[model samples]
Every structure is written in structure tokens, then in C-alpha cells.
Target: MKNPCIRVLATGGTIAGKAGSATRHDYRPGQIGIDDLLSEAESLGMAVTLSGVQIANIGSEDIGPAVWSPLHAATVAAVADPAVDGVIITHGTDTVEETALLLDLTLPTAKPVVMVGAMRPADAVGSDGLRNLANAVRVASDPGAAGRGVLVVMGDRVFAARDVRKVRTRGTDAFRGFPRESIGLVTPSALDWFGAPWRMGEAARFVWPDQWPEVPVLPIWAGIEPDYVTRLTGPDTRGVVVAGVGEGNMPEPVRQVLRELAVRGVAVVRASRIDEGLVDREPEDDANGFLAARALNPPKARILLQLMLASGVSVRAAMQAEFDRR
Candidate 1:
């Protein structure tokens, strides 16, 4: 491909952060603008033409429907444009997994959409943002990446949005794939293959809603009171995902509340607190009218459940089938 045109959608993160000094521990996120960030990435000279679009300049911790809705619209537009070959999203590492998974669930475009972020601020002495941004552009411009769904490029590894997670609180290689390895690897001059791309396309697509539904992730801890769970459910509560103990097991009292909620037409998904494992449905789960989260962690399950509820997909079996898609 000759000078593949890649559109960079910048949502402020550490990748755009500004600090007092190169080694300072404290810094302001999104202090740098998209033009400056993209200019730095372009300076790396990766042979790709770049265009910039600033979606938001706040940290990813504040990312919600407000940011996601517009970002989703911009991504859809970019993928549909004949002149645009691919898309790159510069997002905060803190919540990149959630955003990436949300985009993967909603978008069905054949063009590559790659998200990137950094562990250190853009102005830091050893910042990884520019390299990640450049690698994201490379992945987006690669024809082989077209049908890989949404991807997160970090630490020189390309992770499927569905499988990526932040494993460490701080570090350049904080992200990792759960229940699977990275789909591919990339450096400045080379790309290596691994697992096959796992893009579901229309089969897993969820229409971006005008307003996202209310779905909260509640963690089940020892001695947790039932009122805590009750407080989270109300007139507007569409669904809940409990990050239960091993195999998604919770104390009897909490389980009872969830069962009642499930019977009352509120969707309940039992996701595990364990870092990486399956929460397969069991006979007891069927008897309690609960759905298992399978391989989805609590946060990812929350996003998926939110999309399902917003799309008017409340049937228990249907929702369970969505979880079983892996």
C-alpha cells in the first residue's frame, strides 16, 4: 500500500500527558493536543499519511457514554469513508480495555481500527506513546489487519479488544491478553503472526444507543450484606454483573438477592473475580435463573450487558447466547 491514509482519533490519556519534568511522578493527563501528539508520531516517519481528530482530552477514567457515543460515531464515519484506509485511536491506558471491547462489540467495519496508549506521559524521558502510536498506524495500514475487529497496540503486542486487560498498576507492559495470547506482534520494521483474528462482525454487533442503559458491576466479598446489592437495583437498573469469588460463587445471602433480581426481569451475570478463567454456567446457575459470564471479566461483562439492555435484548437465553459467543 502506498502511503495508507490513517485517521488518528485522539482521546486524551497518558499518551498526551504533560509533566513538570521528564522524570516527575505527577503529571496532568491530556495536557498535550492531538496535533502535537500526531506530529510526534509522524516524525517517526512510518510512511503513513496521518489526519487528526480530537474526541476528548480528559483521562480515560472519566470515559463514559458522553465520550463513547461521539467516538463511536466518528469511528463509524471514518471506516465508511472511501478515502480512509484505516483508523487509529489514542486513548488512556487505564480504561482502554473497556473502550476497545465496547468498540469491538459495536463496530462491524472491515477496515482496521487500532487503539493505542502509553504507560508514561508523552513528555516523559522513556515514554512509549509514540512507538505505540506508530505501531497502531502500522497495524491499521496492514491489509491483513482489516477483519481483526478492534485491536489494542501496546508494548509491541497487538491484542484483540475482547481479550486485552491491564494486569499491572504501573509499567510499560502493563497490558496482557486473558485466556489467549496476543493475535500478533509488531515492531518498527516487522510484524509477526500468532493467533487467528477473532472478529465477529454483524453476528456480534450492537447498535450504538442514543442513551446507554444502567448496568453496574458489583463485587461479591466475604460478609457482604444483601442491602448493598439491593441498593444497586432500582426502577432504572437494567442489569448487574457481580464479580463473584472463584467460579463466580457468592455467599448465600447475595446469591438470593441476585436470584430475586433475575426473577424480577433484571439480567444478572456472574463474572469471576479471578483474573483469568471461565465462569461456565452450572446446574445451580440454571436453577437460580442466572447467566454465567464465561470468559468475560466484570468490566467487560458490564459493558456487554449495558449494550444488551440498551438494545432491548432482555431475554435470558438470548443474553446467555451472547456471552457464549467466544
Candidate 2:
């Protein structure tokens, strides 16, 4: 039997970072290349043929539409290839979850799409990049990983993109699934899944946009000035996501500004500032013409709203429907 062919799509993150010294925490991310990283993985001697494809070499914080467009295109092409069995994206931990969500919403889920990253720089003491890379390859090559949407493998846990979040600033255990536990676990010898099989795919995907839309997340807080809300309205602002306090609530002043924006055809979504909870529609939300972001954090909500605006479909209805999903 042939070895499973996995394309290691590299979007540089800490996994590729190089520190001043093994003991030093300060380092520059994206300093190493995909070929170099793959060489480390190849040393493990897994039954897999790894092809390194360099997509971008930037810290995850710099990830935006410029990188997303090409990443999506390359991923789609790799997935469509007859010889490729699965794909792995090595990304930065800071914003890997957002990128994972974006790919999960746009790509076909028939094959495994795994996002892997390291909390520590590749050259640091106790560096975890190789372990994560090996684990990601294991998951990608696994037949069971198919149709489960994009998976983020870190700390030996496999998280579905929709629920994964970067919870800690530094550590081996930086990522977690919110409101839901990890769907599975991975080890050197075995893979185990705990949840019922659920899939996300092109059947429920948004059309990849030619132009990325401008959707900004505005944070709401105690004594938030009205200018903060009012300034968000402009010709280029296609949508606005408010990281509202507690169940997506804001002061009446902020609500009024949002209401006006909603009336002007800008998509307005209220997502929670809290980490792990649903933002359901309050009674006033309907009257104000606002959509609740449900379990989506502010950043993910912004991504979804941008897609909705870019497609120019039934924006209001689509936003509401997706937010309502379990």
C-alpha cells in the first residue's frame, strides 16, 4: 500500500519561530521555512509522504485577506488533487482559531484539514513544534478525520475549528474548545474520539469572496462613549460586530447607534465579550434589527459577517440562521 500523501501547507507561526537561545522566550516568528520543519517531521519516520508548500511566512497576527485568499486557493487545489490524502496547515497560535474557522466555512470537508501550531518557538527549550507537527500528520492521515471539518491539533487534543480558542498566553496547553470539549485525542500509537460524528463542509460553506469585505469588531464596555459606536458608521463599513457586555447587552446610547446603522443596511451583530457563552437575541434585538452572534466570539463573528457581506446574498437572514445553529 502507498503511504498517505499529506501536503504540509505552511503559514508560519511559532512552530517556525527561532529564538535567540533555547532558554530565551523572545524570538522572531516565521523565521524557519516549511522544508526545514518538514525535515524534522520526516525524522519521525511516520508512514506518510510529506510535501512542503510555503503559503506565507508571517506571524498569525498579520494574517488577513491577503494571506487568506491564497491559502484558500492552495488548500482547495490540494484537496482537489487525486494523489493528496489530507492537508496540514502550520499556523501561529495567536490567531489560528480564526483562520481555522475561515477555512472550515469555505472548504469541502471530505478530506481532513488540520491546523497545527506551537506555543513555544521551534528552537526554544521544551519546543513542541515537532510533536504537534507529528500529531497533525497522524490526524490528517487518519481515515476517521474526514468529514469532521477543519481540526486544530495542540496539546494532544483535537479541536474542531468552530469551537477552538487560544485560552492561555504561553504554555504547551494554549488552545481549548469552548462550550464543548475536544472532539478527539491523539497519541503516538492511537487516536480516540469522544463526540458523535458531526461534519462541516461545502454543503454549508460560504462562497469564497473575490474581495474581502470590511467588518470591524467594536468592543462594548462600562461607560463606553457614544462616539465609539457612532464612529463605526462610514461608507466602507459593511458590517459591525459589537463585543457587548454580558449576553450581548450595551447601553441604550450604543444600542441607538447600532439601530441606526442597521436601518442603513449595515449588518449589525451582537457577540459576547465573555469567552464561553451564547449571545442570544434579547427582546430589544429584534426591534433594533440586530442579530445575535450565539456562541461566536467577537473575532469569529467578524469573519462570518464579512463573508455574509461579501456574498451579497440574504445577509440578514443568513447571519441570523448561522448564529442560530447548534
The 0-to-1 C-alpha lDDT of every candidate, in the order given, reads 0.88, 0.88
Q: Write model 1 residue lDDT over 1-326, tens digit each, in one string.
A: 47999999999999989897998988999998889987787888889889989999989999988899889999998988988999999999889999999999889858899999999997788988888887888899887786788999999999988889999878898998988769899987788868555553444388887787788888888899999998877888878899999999999988898899888888889999998968999999888888899998999999999888889898889999999984
lDDT of 2 by residue, 1-56 (tens): 99999999999989999997999968999999988998899989899999989999
For all predictions, the C-alpha RMSD in Å is 1.4, 1.3
lDDT, residue 105, candidate 1: 88
C-alpha TM-score for every candidate: 0.97, 0.97
The candidate 2 region of ten consecutive residues with least summed lDDT is 195-204
Model 1 bad stretches (over 4 Å)? 198-204
Q: If candidate 1 were superposed on the true structure by all CA atoms, what would the RMSD be?
A: 1.4
